[model samples]
Target: MRRPAAFLNLIFSRRSIRRFRPGKIDAEVLKIILEAAQSAPYYYQAFCFILLEKPEIKREINESCGGDFIEKAGASIVVCLDLNRISGLLDRLGIVHVLKADTYPVESVLGVFESGLAVMNLIMAAEVMGYGTLILDCALYECERISEILKLPHGVIPLVIVCIGEKDENPPPRPRWPLESLFHVDGYRMLSDEESERFLENMDKAYSVEGYLKKYAGWAGSYREYLANRALLTREVRRAYESISAFLRRSGFRP
Candidate 1:
């Protein structure tokens, strides 16, 4: 058994590595990591992991996602929610032609959540195996194209691509909001004006404290401005949403 302290150490030490050394992970180790990921809790195991190892596939994914990091990683796993699997199970149970238009969205949400848990488990497993990991939703921008390239089936919708490789950089942890500001006892309570002001002040202090913000100089910006600019809420993001909606319709998962 791992020492309690060591387990906690591993959790705290893991980071999202953007760069990686050119090396391949052993097949056995990769298998173990995947096994750990599959161990994640789920409602109905309605998800699948697509392991991408081919250089040509990785290159195409990188090109489509507008990044080289995915290609550089030793391996990438695309987490997909298998709506078809769920429907197949329903069919096997003799629930023929049940119109689940309203409930399908909830099922999709639960499937995505379960998939997220599995991906996180895999990330931790990779880190424990002494490999760096990075998760990206950039692939969602070209989800339809990537799915076609990967030859994904009708009901499997790709959520995120996780890259695994040897670490090439060490970086400090990003700032997080204080627990007091975020958590409320028993039932949730909205913060008052004064409390909100204090929270913001604490957040700024945390950002500048230990020179963390300085390390990310020019990379930092105001969230207010970011929201105002609506830069990330691009047509591509909207189209991606529309594509997913269409996929659901095509998969017969809609009302």
Candidate 2:
């Protein structure tokens, strides 16, 4: 078990810092943070992170993402995978090929999950090093235009972006589901209809305090809404996934 006090402190203390002080992060510090990201587990995939510091490139990216604030940070880190290498290995193993849209759907989801975990490591390390981080997936992957801006090869796609700098303010921790409702002694336990209703009702009430409309049912309603907000993205991501998968097959990675 972790020390609750220490863990709680970390949980409450960390916030997504958007405004960065104008200065360069020490080269050694950047190296350590990148190393922390590389330590994350990856399944049959290689991860590469790109650091963006050039003003011109940052400006172009900011324009592509439709958010000029992306250029404000000291630097932006983007995570990508070499899909061409992944596909070739899958071909040899006679496993599912990532080129097919059906086979690549779940694979893309898993790949994104891995990239997210890696970025999280960098964020945590930044906090410990007395820096702040705001991870935004859009800055690196707003649309197909971003790929052109990054000059990403057919098989390489930007998965996520993390902005690092010093925090200017403290952010309060939001409420979470109760611990009892969160854990089960053993096996899997799905939420009962009764519990589901109460769960969402309580959540709606909770967010009401913050002057938000509704929390929706459980978490899916809110998630679905968020997904819909970027509904047009489904096509771009699918195309990018196939592009990388084809590249991976050409490389050496298996399905």
lDDT of 2 at 128: 84
Reference-based lDDT, each prediction: 0.77, 0.66
Worst 10 residues of 1 by lDDT: 217-226
Winning candidate number (TM-score): 1
Candidate 2: list runs displaced more than 4 Å: 1-8, 85-109, 139-141, 179-182, 185-187, 192-255
Cα TM-score of candidate 1? 0.82
For candidate 1, write residues 1-255 as lDDT tens digits.
757997789988898887899977788988999999999998878788888888888888888876677878888888888877777778777665443454446676778789989998999999888999998886555678788899877777778899999999887675566677689889988778887666656656666554544453343554333334545767877886787677656754443
Task: Give lDDT tens digits, candidate 2, residues 1-255.
Answer: 767796567757787775677777788999999888877787655456878877888888777655444677766877775564565667788876554443345565566677777887888888888898887766334534566777766555666677887666555444566666778887767777777667666665555564333322133344335435546567877887686556444433335
Candidate 1 off by > 4 Å: 1-3, 97-103, 192-224, 227-240, 248-255
